[model samples]
Target: MDIKNKVALVTGGGTGIGRATSIALASRGAIVAVNYSRSKSEAEETVQWIRSEGGRAVAVQANVSLDREVRGMVATVVEQLGTVDLLVNNASITQHILLDDLEGATEEIWDELYGVNVKGMFFCARAVAPFMKSNKQGSIVNVGSIAGLTGAGSSLPYAVSKAAVHGLTKSLARALAPEISVSSVAPGAVATRWWEGREEQMNHLSPNLLLKRIAQPEDIAKMICAMLEQESMTGQILTVDSGQTL
Candidate 1:
């Protein structure tokens, strides 16, 4: 849990919270494996930033939804940095979708959203468990959303997917306790490219947030660092909504 010189794999590291976390951990003296699906440039940019900051890091390409790619991702990470000390399941997709906007959603949406947010998360965790067990220690942090808790906002599939993540966190926590720890961070609203072109009026309502503004990626990233190293928390989600739900 010391994190210094430890190894961590962050999915969707190309941008947003994942990128922020990669930089944070690398800056803290940990070797980070940054994962991205198509945003190669962004992933490389994150790596460059980390290296420029005198931190060790490597950018990897992988589709989190595919078990094969997820397996390969972990393998390459371990090949480069040795055993992983932390795994952050941060990859997910959420497009503004009204149920009536189309045909009440479809298999495509379900597959894509659940594939990354739910299935891919568990796949990565499954791949990492053995390594953690072998090492006698590890931490898994799943990036979720406050929308799951509120049961609204994000696409129906997305909310359901995040709920599954929380469930996975609890079951895995209980199953891995005293060994590997599993926890979740359900952010309310962290500004990122994923939100582009989605909202119009709400875009100007940042000042109306409970904390009077939306969150920066670093806010959630640093919290993930703490959870992975804290040693006293697991199986729970720490939401960073600025009191939006309070």
Candidate 2:
């Protein structure tokens, strides 16, 4: 994966790690499609930044939870940028609910989280598979979370959804092997908008980690780029936590 002149699609590319990954890919000479569900302004801003930095990028709108939208998105990217050579399944959602509150983890919550966090990733991969297969080479990095491994996160359903994402990564790796490589980057607490009003909590947790600092979006973005470029690794889950899980 040279990344140079490749076409990269990053879902939820409007903010946080998605945004960072889009920029990183563009810097590496990949023409980037920044997919966003509702963050139109932010997505466009990211594209502008990339262009200003002398990189190529576009902002595509798609609600990744819908299979049709996912397919449509890939089609649009191909029409505009040729083919998708790399994909970052970074779109996800979470709800704030107590871990022990079974009632709080309602059917709606489960469905909502799984729809975007789990199934969305699968749909995107499936839609892009043919393009990658046609080229006989591609790479996918699903953005998972340490919560998936530990079953702890903003909400129970959120954690469960990420766990499913990790599983999906492995299965896709096997299914798309010999042509496409699939892997996952499970990040721990990072300084993103997800902690908008919980700065204090983030601060408290930072010192406890072995690194004694929360990871920035760029840190995870770097790991994601590394995963995309690693030719010998597939079906692997690389964690970018600043020793939070250690």
Candidate 3:
């Protein structure tokens, strides 16, 4: 689990938590495969920043929801970077709506969200599992959300998808144990673009938290690095929520 000179693949690496995680890994001397769906320019920017900081990184576009794309992503990472010793499954989507307005959540919306947040998570993990299996060593970190645990404020479907991510993380950990360490980071409200205009709601909930503030991407990113470099911990869901739910 010593990440020095290791290769790590981060889904949704174009922005937010993924972007932060990519930077973190690169800074630690890990070659990064920055995977993204859209956000092309931002992904490129992240890579540039990493390089500027004397880190090695490359942006790779891939829709984790698509099997072919996921396969191609893994292939490109291995071919170009040499190996995928770590994976951070941070790609996800959310459709915010009140449960009372559930009728408006059409089948298409449900499918699109589920495709990326849940099924896509599986695809990305599956794609990387073999590489780790062959090497007999790897770390897979699936990003989860507090919504999955409490289902308090987040959209229902988004919450459900994250719940599935948590389940997948545990299942994969148990299944891939002793060789590959699978774990999850279920963060609370972090100040990412996803919550751009929702500052009021975030702060309102923050005062109750032990930290009394929302998290920054770097906060979560640092914890991810800990999980990646520390192999002693496995099959655990590390919630970096500032104790809001406590």
Candidate 4:
């Protein structure tokens, strides 16, 4: 899948891995649709940076948690940027509740997290399916987490939601085979704003990792680019965790 002139949509493209992925795709000559929920400014910033680097990009606002918004977003991207040839489902949410604090895991918290982290991915993928299937070729990469594979993360619900994302990756791969290649990139602890006040946690985990440092967004972004370029790979969860899970 050559990225040159390809149209790619990245959810949560305003910040962190999504932001990096957007830039990476643009760098490869893909016209990126940067989707943001509340990080409009940041998403625009990413587009500006891409433009500065002589790449093409646009920031589209949409809350993946809502089906209508997802549909509208896809419609806008198709109308403006043409069909979505690549999709990176990176939008997600997490709570700080501990695994043992089941009481803190209220229904509201569960629903909110699931709404974005799991259901949102499904909606975005489903919305873009027709466009990709009609084109007879596409690539979808769900941004999963090591927590999904290992049952460890910021919170139990967050981990569970990521697990659901991993499941969706496989199911979508099977459902949209040959024409669309579906895969996932599960990253370990990354040094993004999401870890703003979790220095101690990062410090504690670094020495144990094979790389002895946390992953940067670009590290994961490079892996995602590689995944998008693979023509024969599908239904695979490529973990870019610096061997932390080992």
Candidate whose lDDT is highest? 2
User: By lDDT, is 2 or 3 better?
Assistant: 2
Point out the worst 10-residue segment of candidate 3 by lDDT. Answer: 151-160
Best-to-worst TM-score order = 2, 4, 3, 1
Per-residue alpha-carbon lDDT of model 1 for 164-237, expressed as tens digits? 88888899899888889999999887788767765564566576777888888999999999999988888988
Residues 102-125, model 4: lDDT tens digits:
999999999999999999999999
Inter-residue clash pairs, candidate 3: none
Off by over 4 Å in 1: 99-102
Q: List the candidates' TM-scores in order.
A: 0.95, 0.99, 0.96, 0.98
- lDDT by residue (1-246, candidate 2, tens digit) is 899999999999989999999998988899999999999999999999999999999999999999999999999999999999999999999998989999988888888899999999999999999999999999999999999999999999999899999999999999999899999999999899999988999999987999989999999999999999988999999988988887
**CA error at residue 129 for candidate 3, angstroms:** 1.5
Tens digits of lDDT, candidate 3, 21-90: 9999988889998998988999999999999999999999988889899999999999998888899999
Considering TM-score, which of the candidate structures 1 and 2 is the better prediction for this target? 2
Q: In what order do the candidates fall by lDDT, top score first?
A: 2, 4, 3, 1
- Residue 103's lDDT within candidate 4 is 95
Question: Candidate 3: which stretches are off by over 4 Å?
Answer: none
Measured by TM-score, the strongest candidate is 2
**C-alpha lDDT of all candidate models, in order:** 0.87, 0.95, 0.89, 0.94
